[model samples]
Target: MQVRSLVSFLALAARLMLLGGLLLGGLAALAEDRPWLTAEERAWIAQQRVLRVASTPSYGPFTFVDAEGRLRGLSVDYVSRLNELSGLRLEFVAPEPFARNMEALRAGELDLLMSLRETPERAEFMGFTRPYVSVPVVLLRRVGSERQALMPGEPVSVGQGFAAADFLRQRYPDNPQQVETDDKSMLRRLASGEIDAAVMDLASATFQIRGEGIGNLRVQGDVGYAYELGIGYRRELALLGRILDKTLARIDAAERQAMVDRWISLQAERSPWQRRLLLAAAAALALVLLGLGLVLLWNRALQRQVVARTEQLRIELAERQRLQAADHARALAEAANQAKTEFMSQASHELRTPLNAVLGFAQLLGGDAQHPLDALQRERVGHIDAAARHLLILIEDMMTLSRIESGSLAVTPLPLQAGPLLRRCVELARPAAASAGIELRLDEAPLPLAQADPVRLEQVLHNLLSNAIKYNRPGGWVQVRAWAEPARGLLIQVADNGLGLSAEQLAQLFQPFNRLGRSEQQGTGIGLVISKQLMERMGGQIRVESQAGQGSRFILELQTS
Candidate 1:
């Protein structure tokens, strides 16, 4: 009886252990699926067990309802994937018009929105995930419409709740906009000549025209705005936003591409004649493949001869590579000579204006006794002085740039105090800043010593300060700050609320003599180039951050001493 009891106890223990193992495995699988989700996020998800998601009903290819009254599109597929990956209950609300859906989202009647661009107005009430898809906004017009281009006075229809409507209102305000219910209505109006042109995303426009059999409309041109679509949720549901973003990220590139291909495929309806043509084409392709196979078999027979010829060609290839290297060196030399010639031409042109002013003013000054000096003559003398100083500065910048390019410029890095150097630079620029009605502020906090060439660093700082002052708007401010980074480096930033640069301008920022379309500004344009080289020589680096019409910041990083 005791032996029997022992066997039963062993069986019970084994079953308990098995049950515990299964429980642990289930928990491990859950963690693996949602590694980024924090305990707080999981708790929040538990509380909000169901998320009501909606998309525009007429935005085809992205999100739309089919004739069978089912939500189907790329966005629907994305939501389905999100649901599967996140293990969240995403219930779809009934399909509604775009404006009503937006209102529903705003009224807290909906929990999530799919495939919509996040505009500033929407951002006030909702938060957005990173864009998963981007499509260009295109203008559509009827085929052979008299409207060649979107005119200022022409009426352009855009979807009422679409981001393109807000974009058009802001960017092309002169063009009168008629807000339609959706892309379908807008396109229909465009086809019937009620609207001159309509703005919508490429996917929706193409889908509507082909699916609706509206053959009269054609894509006119891009509207310079793209719809970067993403999921948007209520602003207060910050945890939900994180959950959505993490889940979206879990959907890999291949899966996202598959979803896009499933929805955005363009297919042409083939008539009987076209079907016959396709059959003939398929037969021809089969014949071509057979010929290719025969050719491969023939090539196999001559493999040995081909190998010998390949070896000979390899020897010729090596010779060609050597000659190519020589040619590349010659090309570089010619480029350098061309650069020098262009520099000289620009320098001479720059020098002539100031030199002419100086000479002309000096000649007037020399004859001042005959004219008897007046207030205007005195002011002219000051102009002469200013012209001469500008000429001297231009010459110095040119010489410094030449020395840098020739590798003759010396940079001696040594321990130096950053605070005093920054303050001195700001003080030197204060007068210019004041004259330009710009406020210059320097951070007075203690800063660590940095390893940099003092003279070269000062030169770079002066150039940056001058630019901040010169290009600043009236009543703008320039802020200078220096701080020690955790990486044992000192970062000095000269930021200005001035006329900022575009991406194209920033690309050519370091190129010598590229004024970046600011020809009206007084600059030799080589100061930044010289500064970049000088910083590199001193074991440092310089970089800029800018957005057009916003502002610019120039940062210099040096090793902490």
Candidate 2:
């Protein structure tokens, strides 16, 4: 009674101690916003956020450096939103001119830069943000400047204007022009009858002419396509880049549309003919007919090509069907062979189990215990058990190989703690390691939950460890390690100091009955083959890295859940 009371007291004390520890742990966790990250995570973040950003002024009302030099713009707001979602901080720095901004980005003084026209040359060093705004480029003019415009029937000057420049360069090729300065100056020049009208971005002209108090300016007929703006980042922050991509996709579509409307609606007066540019049916009908003829001819040629491709596809499909039939036949043959092999293997193990028991009793019953033993009789009985044990091992290997190859092997995946799995594998292979006079060591860290079929994963680990031990030299060592790579997933490797494999042997390592050791070693060599198949079934893989005399390491990769 006294001993029972003492034990009860100890148990109560232990429960109270556990409860106290749990309370402390919970409080600590609740205090942290992002406690999931460790010191290593801080290092990773440092390596990733390696750049300051630069931007141009008046590029849009969206992006500009204010007098105090803090960044503010449409591009700025979008990037700020991006940072909020990604949890990665960036330094936004704006120095000066667009050319200087680009120079800073190229020289690595900044991590990213924004609000510049995209060119093939820029794509070489940077990645672009998702296009958030597309605006038309145009030149607004008063009602009287059409006939007096210089270069009227000459060629358009492009290379400097935005969308209109791009369109005229491609569409009319006859006339193009741009004002290097502000549209108001061009408007003054036009009001005073110097040049015809100013070529500027459509939004700029609208803001200059009406929103900012200049008069007598209105958009010409529909200018062209949209001049889309996108942010630019360096090429190396791929994960962060991908995160931004997903975040951008999640932003409300209406919100993006509102931003466009808010910025552009603050700025334009529609020209009278803007709504009627395509309203002339007689003129448009003639152009439509010409376009239709070309479209029909191109469509007719496309149909011919499609028909030829369809026929080629038909022939290729027939060839594929033939190959499929051949593959099916081969699969059936393999299944049948595997069935036979498994039956023989299991039968041998079962049959020899009883035979071994019988042979043991017979030898004991016929021994020199009761009377003088006949050496020949004892020897015969010993031979029966000796042969049976050897046969049993071979049978076991063949059964494993057969079931695995036939795809009848079951694989059940769960999130497993990595450290315990390695320990278990080492424990299972301990006897073999002892027999070889080799040391088996496991190097493990706190790893993530591995998505794996525990039984099959353990089987592969055990087989590798067993092989390592079985083929190793005396006093040799076998090491097993588990590591996690955020990018590459999980790695579990088993290495050995042993008689290593040749290139030819390595190539055939995962083939059934392929033994790398001499005839002296005890392996049917189906373990690796079975291991490979089972690993694949679980969406894991096994690969061997080896040198002829130095030894071999077999790496197993698993997805971390």
Q: Which has the greatest TM-score?
A: 1
- Candidate 1 — what's its lDDT? 0.79
Candidates in order, TM-scores: namely: 0.50, 0.39
- What candidate 2 gets wrong by more than 4 Å, as runs, is 1-387
lDDT of 1 by residue, 173-203 (tens): 8988787877777787778988778888777
Q: Candidate 1 at residue 104, lDDT?
A: 91
With a 3 Å backbone cut-off (N, CA, C), the pairs that clash in candidate 2 are 52-111, 62-73, 62-74, 63-73, 63-74, 155-175, 156-175, 156-176, 157-176
Number of backbone clashes in candidate 1: 0
Candidate 2 root-mean-square deviation in Å: 30.3
Model 1 steric clash pairs: none
Q: 1-561, model 2: which lDDT tens digit per residue?
A: 999999999999999999978865664444333343344443344345435777655444655455676666566776677666444566666445555666677777777665445555676787665444545455445675553222445432222323345556564565645534333455666555565555565555554455346665555433323455556777675444444544554455466665555555532455778657656766789899999999999999888765357688899999999999999999999767755754553454346446556656766756657675578876776777667666666666665664454333335454566676688778878887887799988888878877776556777787788788877899999999989999757899899879888898887777767666567876777778878888887788888899887899999988887
CA lDDT of each prediction against the hidden true structure: 0.79, 0.64
